[model samples]
Target chain A: MEPQLNLVRLKTMYEKMVLIRKFEERIIELVQEQGRIPGMQILANGQEAVAVGIIESLNAEDVIVSNHRSHGHLLAKGADPKYLMAEIMGKSGGVNKGKSGTLHLAVPEVNALMTSTVVGAGPPLAAGAAFAQQYRDEPNITVVFFGDGAAAEGSVHEAMNLAALWKLPLLFVCENNCWAGAQSYSQHCSIGNIAQRGIAYDMPGEYVDGNDVEKVYDLAVSMTDYCRKGKGPALIEAKTYRMRGHGENDHQHYVDKEELVFWTKKCPIGNLKEKMLKEGLITEDELQVVETVSKAIVDEAVAFADESPFPYAEEALDDVWVK
Target chain B: MAQLSFGQAVNNALDLAMSMDESIFLAGEGIGVSIHYDPNMPSHGLLEKYGPKRVKDTPVSEAAIAGLAVGASCMGLRPVVEIMFLPFITLATDMLVNHAGKLRYLSGGKSTFPLTVRVKAGVNFAAGCQHSHNLEAWLAHSPGLKVVFPSTPEDAKGLLLSAIFDPNPVIVIEEMGLYWGKGEVPEGDYRVPIGKARIAMPGKDCTLVCYGGATVTALEAAAILSKENIFLEIIDLRSLVPLDRDCLLNSVKKTGRLVVLHDATKFGGFGAEIAAIVAEDAFKFLKAPIKRVAAPDIPVPFSPTQEKFYKPSARMVVDAVKSITG
Candidate 1:
């Protein structure tokens, strides 16, 4: 039997994941070419499926709040790539008019409400967003994308408890990528499965192989449906790996060479392509088109950002007050 | 017209603002129950009127409460959250300073985040520095926040209403000592314009500027000085950031002498800012060096005796004015 949104979303998820991977790699190219993008560059290069698959399962009105490495989630949630790319380049056409840069990009039109660099901060904010939707009797849900590093923060636990207690329409999506700024998950936390912490908060806790896009999407669909039905919040721990170091400057000497090899072999994009070919979902020729289209779109985004002008220095004082 | 205490005035303000605006909601730790019915003293009886949905009681999660307020405000709801004490604000500062104050600016003015934070402040409680430290200057120093401190019941009611409606994050610093102090208050829909100072007791000899609990001391000092034939003009600086600069400069220009007072520690206190402004703008008009009467550089002690010493008193204000006037 076909799972809910399984086969139909698979092709789209593959395309979206390719675009996300391409977008993240483009930042690396810019780093080497332009001596970095004028700000702290954190790439979600390997965590592509977790972002693409879960976002693909969400509805248009659903809200998503994310953290520093948020480009993947923003792109997958239908943010305009040109504007987002411009934001990364510190251009006036950026989503926040270049004020937020890559870290705190907020695209309200896509229901991507907030992106904060503060670790573990997004969940509490998302809980509040969920509170608003619930208070308004709205059917939409708010999803917070945070990493395993954020899970160790007390605020995350507080958000979970608060959301569960108030029965808020929130879904906490944890991308457990095993490294929190050079510190391994084992060093930071004793709890192997963050999803199980949902039990302490009295919510459903589920875990899935993050590199498997289909599994992540199916689980996200179920949880979003649960929250939309006013069933309160749930937690999903997508076990994955960070293929590179934490930031643009990190050389990953602190990381294990063998661990990198293992995650690279399990690369979400590669696994998805293999699965699609094995299932006869797309022929080799169709796959090539998807890759070409994704690359061209990313190239266009870079061009748009390159052509976008930087904001004037005086503009910094403009938006401090709403009046 | 009705007589209400400073605490009752806040309740009146919340009741009126919430009724007039459906989008307005209250959230904090035990805001419904009044946090042991103590510092929550302002939001008493609101939970019954608005119910759990609007008048929310939260866990002892300052970050969550602050973040919730920021998050809800972003989504078009007006949340007036109570962060119980001043020092605890450090826990919520990330959400308040980084997100709440910064979000509207980051949005390039495309959105308005209209939320109010009711902060309990002062040193008179003798509850130690943890619960009683004053942080108005810190809030004011942040670029995107509006800070107001009311020393009387009428100003409390009016300022809270105005703060609740303002399009920026307005921090209403309530002096815990003045909560039970009573005064005449307008009944409904009254508003005191923020960033404006009031002349508590006017005179021509010297200008004494103060706010929150210190306003009481300044008024008392003016009375004592007046009896001694030294007429002290007392200006209650209601707000810190937008700071009634013209009223202050004009007052300093009139009296030709200035003294600033607050309960916060002397070094780097908001009083220093006031002193600097007068020193810069109205320097030619000054007849004496600007003086500041403030708490010594120390924490608010828990002992009532040391706490009394830790507080800025009328005697301190009078002594400061005397030194500058002499």
Candidate 2:
């Protein structure tokens, strides 16, 4: 049963997750080295599996709209690392030519559409893209990656209701990292599980352990298939943890030390590495190669960003109109 | 040429544009109804002709639907969205002002949000307060938006076509007061170029710069002032941004006197920008200080008498010209 799960695909997923983890880790160092406080540095340290596993099931033709914590989803959805790294460093060679820094990133080639700064904003956009695809008679699906905090927004509920009513090929993925800024899900939301809200919209609501990459990957595959076949919109709530604060400036004194320790132990990358080794799906040497390759790629990306030139001041006036 | 009301002209423009381009779709509330609600509304027979797929009647989620239009436009579709009333556009500010207007700039010119929003503004049918706020000034303030307020039925048809085809986001501000106003519109294809002002009634003494509902007042004032040998030049500023500054400065440069007019309140109204622009650049050519004739700083009242006073009328424009040209 383990061997039938496709070792090559699983191996790729593991490597992608490693790249996301290492990419984030390196960005923090870069921000620190710059001697400036990172303004809105949101790292998806523990939420790697949710982005990687779900994105693994999507093709380049499909669309994905992400929230502020979007680097993981961008990388996992096949966004070029060099451009993304350059973008984060505010270089002209960035994906948006340095116009959008950490919060907003759009790579259209892979159908990785806009990443919004506003919470709950991406779902409506995802539904819009899905509407176009459906209208054009295309088989593409749209996935919106938002957090538990965003699910509490009226915009998200409105988007969900509209998507369901329109029967769009849309999937709403809620990465319940528990803490929205300093507030916890318990305090912010009246409902226990965010997925339960999907029931009101007459859609299937599924929850999975976000720490387990295999479970998320399997569920995403089935869900994407269901949506592709035009079964209407669906929702998936990944019970994940926020390993770090909301932004780089946050001290996270409001977070429990025990909760941090618990999530650290259940790191998605560590869990996958252990599962693969015990199942004899991958060798110890193979795992080391994944780390080495990921580090080298990240190193190249950082160097590219470092050497890239900043755009001219006059260039700001350009791209405002499409004439 | 056929005589069409402003509403019929708007309907004809949508039908013509949609027929030409399959990518152009209509999304909004109250657009697909059978009854003629607001003279020449966008819906009428559109739903029946184009079906639900093209003429999308969305739920009252302006933010989501507006975002949907922006999202769809970014991915290579032209969406002509309607916010029903101008006041409801506040609910969609996130999508309209933030995303639609900023996406192209944020993408460093790689992406374009070719989304057109139709907003019915002003008071005429006693749709007081929430339904009758003149807010084109709010939209014109955004950099990326091409805000066009067409006065006549012909201009409405031409401007709506241009707005639909523009690669950038455009706010087509339709005056509720002018929906039933009839005018001669040319047959077949024609476009009233966006960002260009039209000389509604040209004169040499003073320039009356106005748009939307205020155009009617300005024209009436021009006729009344003509009887007194004032001979005011009436310039209907069709577009707000990419403003026909050339036409305005040329007119101001010729007349040496200017009066900015609008249905919006006098305080921080769009007229202020016109006044400031003329004062800054064309001050040397001015014989008198720039004057503004606009609605008072208050909401559109319910009573017909109060509503009459709340909106700027032809009498106010004449009074303003008298004060400025004195």
Maximum-DockQ candidate: 2
lDDT of 1 by residue, B8-30 (tens): 99999999999999999999887
Model 2 alpha-carbon drift over 4 Å, by segment: A1-5, A35-38, B34-39
Report iRMS (Å) of candidate 2. Answer: 0.9
Fnat for every candidate? 0.66, 0.68
Worst 10 residues of 1 chain B by lDDT: B32-41
TM-scores of all predicted structures: 0.97, 0.98
Q: Look at candidate 1 and give me any clashing residue pairs.
A: none
Candidate closest to the true structure, highest TM-score = 2
Number of the top candidate by lDDT? 1
